[model samples]
Target chain A: MLLKPKTSILQKIYLPDIIIGLWITIKNFFFGKKVTIQYPEERRNYSSRLRGMHYIKTINGVENCTACMLCPTVCPAECIHIVAGERPDKEKYPISFEVDVLRCCFCGMCEEACPKDAIKLSNIYEMSMLKRSVYEKDFLLEQRGHK
Target chain B: MDFIDWIILGIKIGALLIALLSVAPVMSWVERRGSALMQNRLGPNRVGPFGLIQPIADAVKFMFKEDPVPGHVSKFYYVLAPLIAFIPALTTFSVIPFASSIEVMGRVVRFQVADLNVGFLYIFAIAALGIYGVVVAGWASNNKYSLLGSVRSSSQMISYELSMGLSVIGVIMIFSSVNLNDIVRDQGNVLFHLGQFAIPKWGIFVQPLGFLIFLITVFAETNRLPFDLPEGDSEIIAGYHLEYGSMKFAMFMMAEYINMATVSGLLATLYFGGWQMLPGMHTLLESFSLSGSLSGITYEWVRIVFEMFSFVIKVAFFMWFFVWVRWTLPRFRFDQLMGFGWKVMFPLSLVNILLTGIFIKVM
Candidate 1:
């Protein structure tokens, strides 16, 4: 694990970083202020270009997803899977679909590679779940968030 | 016997006042200066030539600042907290023996105030009392963060006090004296001279491990770097004194600095031979032109002055050292700090005591 020469006379078996860490503390204490910046008064700066949570675009309740299987192949983590069936118009559409977000690497390649532009990756990153199964959702309804 | 001694008493009182005042400001300056150097930055140089009168400016600002009491707090305890923090810090110095006594105007005047046999015990008791102020400050504030900080501080200090007391027991056995002067006197002994070098072997040499343990314990007790968990600025927001402002906040700080100075002085007296020059240096000084005995009153005055200088130099060096160490080390985390004190320091202290016993018997 060590980068230094093995036969070097001062090659210490134990790392002495603990003492160095202490010294660093001493340095910071003297150098920096307590910096109890009033939270409301002093807001941390965020870049304007930063993408946040996702939003879905819909026209009169019609959506673009179209049960595309192309997204499933493009996902690096193999998180996307879709089951398709014939609609009343005889056009094929997805009957069942699931995104195993637990396995998702979030590379966003699936959205970019979609040929029909039907799938889009959401900007949302604040997702949390107590159980892995909770992340394995059955549907993608936006406004009605999960309990 | 008459009018002049009355004048002399006034002069002594004036001197003591001056001494205390100078030490206070100088200690502040030293702390800031040492911190600056340690941090690789310039400290307080704007006012009065490298911030010499900074303490005066600070004192003035404190005096003029508006005092506030939150409606949720207990007025009595809030007001009392600062005093509790400040008093014990200054009081512990009363038993210190600075130097030897000499005859002045046909009367013997000791260099120190009353020396108590239980001097070290008195220090322990006084320092322990400081926790009460911190605890009460937290409880009276009605702030969750401050309350938690105060509780943590009182508990941490109380727990470490055991190891602190245990660590110093070896010194007690070695010198068998709680009176600081006696401790210094015992350490001044030289069994033999080594060629050109005289050996008045300091306590540090004989008990390096005890010295190390004592140093670590004192750092925790004084609430300084690495051990300053109570005042963890980031996580705790000024700890017990978070709710306090103006002069009250200033008082807590003043107490902490005074504790630093007090502990540093105690360290010097305990391990570094109080005011005495080290062994070879003592011999070298003896070899100088003034080698013979002196019986005159002038000689007595000269001796007193020199001894006082020795004590001052020793105490000042140790105070500087406290700042040096503060800048040289980092703070420990809550869990790590507790682990270090209880698991590491306490056990090592017991082992040190055993080793000291072995050394005493074998040596």
Candidate 2:
């Protein structure tokens, strides 16, 4: 086998990728719309089916939660915690109930497992706080007009 | 100081400030838009009309973002580098003839900020000094990539500058004047006859090859397209500016656009007959009929304003052209790039000089 040294040297490296990449980019610049989305004021619309932050609701100044642990049992992230207490007046209903905001995975399984329509996923995704405790939104209904 | 001199000084200072400030942000938008257009896409349409507010948003982001300085950087020089980078970019614009002179408040106002006898040389010298900023900034960065980038930028500038300088030499030789204004005037006469049409003696016609060489060299020097290896983001991660943050980075951005403006101005002056209108446009405008408002300004002032607008339009076209080429051409490899510059561009420029000399001597 007789291979010329110059050809061998040339064949060792064919560095046309950079140039070709640029050409393609240049072609694309004239051909396609760039996908850098401007954020904030011009927001991307989320799909209706998109899962987001969990919100607990109650009507007639009562929480629908009955110290249920069924929803927490199915959560994968182990990001939820609950504490419950039996009501002194009503034997069937539990009085005290707590859900750790930090631990809750915002999964719809929690909403699905609720005996009543107590837990729901809201469209609100931007949830931030200065402290971990500040993220804790109390589930109790407002007494009169007070929160 | 005399009131008229004060007026001139005020005009000069004000014009510089406005031009310097406005061009930076506007060019950024132009770059993004031009790039998108070249790629057949709409870029940055959300902020303002055609993404005009993108620059503003970017400025705000820069302002609000926390300033970070690398601990490894040479603290003083790193901080000082951007100022050095930007100052020289504006230095060339001092000689750029944007319009003809006009009488303002009984005082004659020249379009340019300054017209040094060494106008052309001053531009070259100032432009050359800019490499120092890149070199220092790169070294001060104390990073391998930035150092490499700076070194590459300096070498590239030095190499292409030879060709660019030589190209200008031909123009200077042919015109027999280094004054930018005089060169434009020299090109006013008809170079060739084509029946009813007299081809204006533009530098493009006189030295087509030289003009091409000059254009290519300017592109390289300004680090736009095909020759943007210095800041090749994919590999180098913004190169010399990798460590910069806040306003420091903004200065570099400002410097690049200003360089674009400087080169555009130079190209307009050197090749496209500066602010001189094409013969047909001039004739049409002269014979035009438009209802005039009752303004006190004379015909000469209006003409000055008109000429200024033309200069701006020309510069803007070149700016867009830079972006167009940037999206059009692929970058050359390091060695191929060097070879093309030293081996190809250098020789071509030398040949251009010889040809120009022969043409000038014989014709």
Candidate 2 residue runs with Cα over 4 Å from true position: A1-48, A55-68, A87-147, B1-10, B32-72, B102-109, B193-195, B278-280, B288-297, B327-331, B354-363
DockQ by candidate, in order: 0.10, 0.26
RMSD of 1: 14.2
The numbered model that scores best in TM-score is 2
Reference-based lDDT, residue A32, model 1: 59
lDDT of 2 by residue, A67-103 (tens): 5677667776665566566666434434434455676
lDDT of 1 by residue, A87-147 (tens): 6853776666677777777676766776655555554445676767323222353522111
Q: What is the alpha-carbon lDDT for the whole of candidate 1?
A: 0.72
lDDT of 1 at B32: 84
Best by DockQ: 2
Across B1-363, the per-residue lDDT of candidate 2 in tens digits comes to 597787877888688768977899998888877776665666778887778889999999888889888899999999989989989987778887888777776777778888677778889999888878888899999999999889889889988999899988889888888888888878878898999888989889998988988998999998887898788887788888888998999989889999999999999888988888745666645554243432346556666666777787888889877876676667778898898899888998999999998998789
Query: Best candidate per lDDT, number?
Result: 2
lDDT of 1 by residue, B1-363 (tens): 588766665665566545654576677877886677556566776679978889888888887899889888888999899899888877776666677767765777655555688978889899899878888898888888888888889878977898889878988878887888788877778845789665665678777888888887898888887778788888888888988888899888878877876787678778777766533444444454276554467565655556667777877877776676666666777888788778878898999999999988987
- What i-RMS does each candidate reach, in Å? 6.0, 4.3
